[model samples]
Target: MAWTEAKLIAEAILEGFERHFRLFRETTAGAQARFEQADWPAVQVAARERIDFYDTRVGETVALLRREFHLRDPSDTLWRRVKVEYMRLLPQINQPELAETFYNSVFCRLFDRHYYNNSYIFVWPLISTEHLEAEVPIFRPYYPARDGFARVIARILRDAGFERRFRDMRRDIRCLLLAIRSRFPANRAIQQNFQIAVLCAPFFRNKGAYIIGKAINGADQIPFVVPILNDPEQGLYVDTLLTGVEDISNVFSFSRAYFMVDTEAPAAVVDFLRPLMPRKGKAELYTAIGFQKFGKAEFYRDFIKHLRYSSDEFMIAPGIRGMVMCVFTLPSFPYVFKIIKDRFPPPKEMTREQVKEKYQLVKMHDRVGRMADSWEYSHVAFPLDRFSPALLELLDAECAGSLERVGDQLIIKHLYIERRLSPLNLYLHSADDDDIRHAIGEYGDAIKQLAAANIFPGDFLFKNFGVTRHGRVVFYDYDELCYLTECNFRDIPEAPYPEMELSEETWYTAGPNDVFPEEFATFLLTDPRIRKVFRARHRELLDPDWWRARQASIRAGHLEDVFPYPVERRFRKDREEFPRRYPHLADG
Candidate 1:
């Protein structure tokens, strides 16, 4: 027979309860007999045996409903009753913030156990990691009803109840503190009135207009003190969110706009946002402005210009937050975009704030051009035409030939001379060459310099390094250019690449007692021709153990702790404690 609406709803509720029970059984090591044989009230009484984390509060609530309501399958009906009880008991928790945090955390954890395998641990996302996708903002593990219930409860709390509670707080000190501690910034105004309802509901629900008049008369302060924006059309209040957070670029808003700063953003990203703007005529002119400002000619002459502003080198462009994102721009030979920020900028320096604010204007302008992704504001792709000439000047001094730029990206074309001492030589190390060992040595030294400047080959394979036509060694593909501090050079082992043998997490083995050891020999000897070069210059790469030693030095001190943004003024406390905590590396 086809099920009625009530039966369908009941089945969903039953299934959700069954999943929770199965999860509990799995968690407690299949100890269903222990639970079944025990008194539900007594279980809760035993849980409160100590003020420790999980007592029988859940069981107590379950037992109360089963006995009072004459209910069977209490688990299926308990959630709604428990939410009511949770709402009722809010006035008593010592630290309501801590209590609410515990409630939400336990709620999610319990549901997670029902849906996810214990073997697969959840990974905490890092800074700027993506948030829930647009399509699915929240998940309802047990069925859609429970999810609907929570949202409805929150909405009720926000809409009709908060104002009266804030006004009459003096009548009940405990409930007043509970509201303060919950600190629900999002819906404070509405929740305040709800707090008053929670306080008087048990006794006053049936009381006539007199009690309600008294509650209103007792209210001296105006309600709705906190301003909350619930409208999606207005978007997030950027300034309020960004005020203190310095690392804004990696934030959800910025990363979602990644296509905005990358070479491959969708056309709709620009087109859809265009209508929101007031002025339309300036679109083409904006692109022309950026092209002229940081154009190819200007970039070459001021390649190292960013370094002069190193002390104040951070940018504060508008992002998701009211706080500006920190930025670092480099006009170096290859051109680089590094994000630099001081989490806390000096309040006295309004000028610095203004400069960063300009970046938002740049982003706004680029958004109109549809070049927002790779326009100068976001860092344009390398201008190969301007770059090739300077590179060739460096390489030709050591070669019989020169190099040329192809399009806007750097790529090798005239690969004729075999033994030429060009900078691009390292990439062609595997190619036949006279004095192959000597060629390898030049290529290796050049790579070492590039590595020092915070650039490393994406593929450390010997073939990836190459000699340019001008006889200089140059690195090309920078898609995975690692931060210099993150690379380990002296330890290039000959073993199969770690990525090949094991997963990324389990691959690296760091011995507790092992001092950093230089192991460049293993890498150099991975191939015969390279091995010959390693033996020839065994001193430079191996002696001081440049890679291992430098890495240890970088990791040992505050250098490793430098964030992408400028140092915050608030970190003075951390700085003071750093030397005391890390005595051995204190001087560093």
Candidate 2:
């Protein structure tokens, strides 16, 4: 039977949809079974395999449509018809949810849109590390033969009215490449198969800047650049000709742009490019930046220079645990810097390696910096030649004396510095009743904001938080920070006997991720007054149901709006309402 072109295309799309759904169902079921069995490693492997299968299947589906139906153009009428047909057929599918997802996935590719619109653009230089050895080197532009993907991307940008800008920026990028090559030459063959891609992203303009360098490979393929709206403010700082790749590249308006190098990049390369990155130390003196390290020289020159202290006068804070980094105050600076100890004293029944691993994980969390409104971070280095004789002598007397020295340089590991609170602790040592009430309220608000941002402060202890000068509570400790979604929110399993409830261990088999939000009341609200206040104001936080609802909302892609500023700055009223309130404004 001869079928019309439209009918043939619709039938092909449906077949592709079914193929995708079948594969998805099989993979999901297998992965789910592994997850239920608590075989996380197997689950991870399955998840990766599923993604690979999906990509291959989608590519095939796209190829089939292009080859057989000749439906190449995204803006083609046939694409629209296919979408309409999929919607009509969705209800008839045995697995409607999977069908809907399949439709969205194909539709997004056909329509030239991303499934998830990421805020950052990752730019990787394809140059070999060995070739980077030239005193001045120029990198050749190498576009891989990838099924006209580049041409398609160019066409999309052209249709968006950004072709000219993209071309201009590409030319500038070539110039930057030439500059980098000439400045740093390598002696060895530049044969590193994968090089670090420079991460360029826009962040809040007013917030502090942070950068981290680490080598990562063998994960996922890099993403293509997408067009963004132009922000006038961003253009002033970033050389559009140098960094801009059309509208998709214009990101500075929403936040400052950051240029980060990969750890594999030579120190010389990083040093040369340092000036091009955003300036560090922009936050207030009281603001703390987590997960920072500085060379011995840099620690003294850049950080210690700003701090005024005689070597003899440096006093470490009391009650320092192996897990808790040593904190010291500076007369010149309002904030105190925390230096992680080389080895943490192991807790009972735990090996030294385990304690070290736990500490390392905490440091890793600090580096990720996901907690909203948390402390800022920066990497710094000081020169040994610049240190004064008095400073050198002081370093000899204090804990700095035992620091690991490399040649003439001392490595300051993961320094977290924040504003020194008056009481030095958020848990009120001798605050009035009203102050305690205010502190608890602020703490509740902090928890809500963290939850909204998908962060769960693993340890909900009051000592883990600090009160800022403005009386706002901020979480400072990150040893136990984990994603709220990662936790299995559950009600405590009931015990067969009443006496069993008093036992230290649980009767039911609890997984590593299981969390009982209800227990927070007993753990955090030890004080009677604080408990009463928390129960009256933020009682919902103690309910596991609330957490589960939030997790579901997040899974369904509901993002709670979290603002950095105060409520008054939000301008909650409608623009039309403003005109009604002031008729004179309308006349103007």
Candidate 3:
């Protein structure tokens, strides 16, 4: 057959996406070995590196096309044909959605948003993931009725296929049975149809593997997770039983590191998980399991659909304006668009690339449930009429380099999309006393957790943090983020003379990374009531010694436990007063 240009381009793009997915799957497959060997550091490194795989492949493919096709500003007719050719190639691949996203990315990079539509790019997916079938079964169903509930639970744990032995399989089984009896649908009729369906793969993430499944009885089903821990000497043991939508979704929370799950059929895996976490969008679930590029594609399509249906205008996000980022959001949507300013003001002294690297650093690190996940995009277009006048003016003035007005649409050159959150400072204004207390304590805990994960939010202002739907506090500002070890935690030196304190002159010399924890109380706790409340319980947060101690522990190779759920959610026997470096495991 003669090689048509459209067919050739489609083939090359498909080849590129396949190469990327294959490499992604191979690295994901290595998670099993990493988990079995208790090689957590390697797992963390690989998870971070894997995020770059899609972009690396895209760059390579783009270069090849540019070199071979001389593909700069191709005619719209050619790209329309290219799109048609790509759709023809979709039926053969397992992930046509991902391939179309790749083609869109390659097409956008070659030119502009002149043809950012179904004609030249995949503004909407060309394939349907509904009723997708995998060659192998996506999940294994176990009948507790036949095998006995306790025995089935035991069998499932064994079926996890870990190389190490369970420390106390019998005890773990008893625990699981007790939790199931208590939390499982209690109606007697429902119990007759009770069965557990477990995903066929272990979800590996920072020192733990979660057995994701759902317990069903008739039309009602309860999502559950069996989180297992590993110890070098003790092998593996069940940590706790996490059931219900809230607990299960927390395990797959966007605030934490992505899980490395080996799978041949991602669409099937997602289909199984969608019911388990209905509140989490398909994009988030895909991103959670390490296919972030496809997640981006999902997010973009949803965003475009929302924009098309809604009449709301985009306005500045409600908060103190950031010096480094100009953030805006539609009134109806729950996400915000953050664009790095063309020029940062004084004190925010970093190049645009430097600021981007900071966000990248956060993306790779274990967020420890304190940092929000950001989805990045380039050349994103929206109708010019959708933007409020003030927002348009702000974007023009502050983010000119990141914006391009192309005809009736406003195209953002580069931007980050993140879940919208109520800024802590703003939320505290209207919050009741109990809520204020909760936010304050959570804010302190958030900082401590980040330190435990070797991360430091350089700015300690309340505005840098935000309150989630669940009232949990999370850090979103990353302009001044750094590794905890990089900062020198210190106390403010005593003024040489008492008058020097009044003079506001240099009482001491501070290095670039010097952090005076004591001063956090000064500017951060401006409200006397809030200050008193914060100091009463979390005074340690303002202590330099405590900060230094946490830094030292991180430096000594300690990986502190970061639980997504609250202390009350942990099983009673597994609960400990103090945080541990490693998780509980069973010895042979």
**Can you give the TM-score per candidate against the true fold?**
0.22, 0.44, 0.93
User: TM-score winner among the candidates?
Assistant: 3
Quote the positional error of residue 45 for candidate 1 in Å. 63
RMSD of model 1 against the true structure: 27.3
Give the lowest summed-lDDT range of ten residues in model 2.
118-127
Weakest 10 consecutive residues of candidate 3 by summed lDDT: 579-588
Error of 1 at 334 (Å): 15
**What is the per-residue lDDT of model 3 for residues 1-588, given as tens digits with 9 covering 90 to 100?**
223887888889889989999999999989988887888678788988999998899999999888888463555467677778889988887777778888887887777566676778887886886656455587889998888877788789988878788877766776676566566455667566678899989999988888989988888888889988877787777888998888887788888899999887788889899988888889999999988888988998888789878998999999999999999999899999999998988977899999999999989899988999999988887899989999999999988888778789888888999999999999989888888789999998999899899899999888999988877899999999999899998888888778997875668889999988888887888887788889986899888899889888877777777877786666555423212411232211
Candidate 2 lDDT tens digits, 263-374: 2223233332332333323221101211021122123334554543333233444322326355655554555656544444544334434434444443323221222122
Q: What is the lDDT of residue 41 in candidate 2?
A: 43
| TM-score: the better of candidates 1 and 3 | 3
Best by lDDT: 3
lDDT of each: 0.30, 0.44, 0.84
Model 1 accuracy (lDDT, Cα): 0.30
TM-score for model 2?
A: 0.44
What is the clash tally of candidate 2? 22
